[model samples]
Target: MSDKALDEEHEKYIKEHSALFANYAKAEFMIKHNYISKQDRLDMAEKQEIALNRVEKQEKRRERLMKQIIPRFVLYFAIMTLIYLFFRWLSMYT
Candidate 1:
């Protein structure tokens, strides 16, 4: 085959099967390099999941606290406004 035709064939093969082969190659490289064992990777992934869940729960708690606090804040402001108006009326009479 001509060099140009061979290149075209290789490109076509990559387009068709690159994802599968790439996954295999990545796993192979990782195992061969011994940078991380499979069990260690799984443990890290599980710890990450737990950490993410804890963060999500804290966010939810903060949101709920804000929801409860906003209405109390509005009520406090309204009560203060009414007290100020009442004192102003008393001053006008004096």
Candidate 2:
């Protein structure tokens, strides 16, 4: 192919797939250079902060539910234990 025709073809290919080409080139460059940008570090920190907040909210909700459940459970167990002891005492007497 003539040089002019080859250049035109390459330009057309780049125009047609500009985004894909840019992404591929960026990935290749990052792999070769092993460098992370400040923006990437900031984004990672933001994501970690969001995740920590979500986990903390979940833990607070779990603790609230546990607080409600534990007393009910303890009350139920105490009543059951008292009933069992009363039954045993009556059986022994009779």
Candidate 3:
């Protein structure tokens, strides 16, 4: 194979196999270098299922308030204010 054809084949192989080998090289490098400490890993593991459940509950509660209650409140306020202004405008004209 010519050098250009070999380069194209290597590129094709890399593109085809990227998903199968995703982050493998980076993991290998990290294992050799050990960037994070064992203590930090233990700290991450301390946040177990209970903590995750609490966080998920809070997220759902916040989502409900944001998606339902707050928007309803704002819509009611805007609609009532507009209706009141329309009545006041009519009363003034009459």
Candidate 4:
């Protein structure tokens, strides 16, 4: 296609999808920040729901990681303590 024709087509396409592009930008911004600022108002109900869900999902993932980390740390400490006690007792007998 010629440059002028291509330009016109591009402009038309953008005009048709302007709302879609705006929504995508908003969603991208929200995902990066993980929360909307007080100054930024979410006009659409769908956008609000998506933000709430993302925040909740992050919290759940954090809780899961904490649960896993605490148990592993306690198990490691317990094993090390047992090994130290065993060596001390063996040295005393010998």
lDDT of 2 by residue, 1-94 (tens): 4579667855755564575446556755765686767676566557656755765675687578769878988999999999999999999989
Model 4 misplaced regions, further than 4 Å: 1-43
| Cα distance off (Å), candidate 2, residue 54 | 1.2
Q: For this target, which candidate reaches the highest TM-score against the unseen true structure?
A: 1
- lDDT score at residue 84, model 1, on the 0-100 scale: 100
Error of 1 at 76 (Å): 1.0
Candidate 2 has an lDDT of: 0.69
Candidate 1: Cα lDDT at 48: 53
lDDT of 4: 0.71
In model 4, the number of clashes is: 0
List TM-score per model, in order.
0.56, 0.45, 0.39, 0.53
How many clashes (backbone atoms < 3 Å, residues ≥3 apart in a chain or on different chains) does model 1 have?
A: 0
Worst 10-residue stretch by lDDT in candidate 2? 12-21
lDDT value for model 1: 0.71
Model 1 weakest 10-residue run by lDDT: 15-24
Sorting all predicted structures by TM-score, with the top scorer first, yields: 1, 4, 2, 3
lDDT of each: 0.71, 0.69, 0.64, 0.71
**What's the candidate order when arranged by decreasing lDDT?**
1, 4, 2, 3
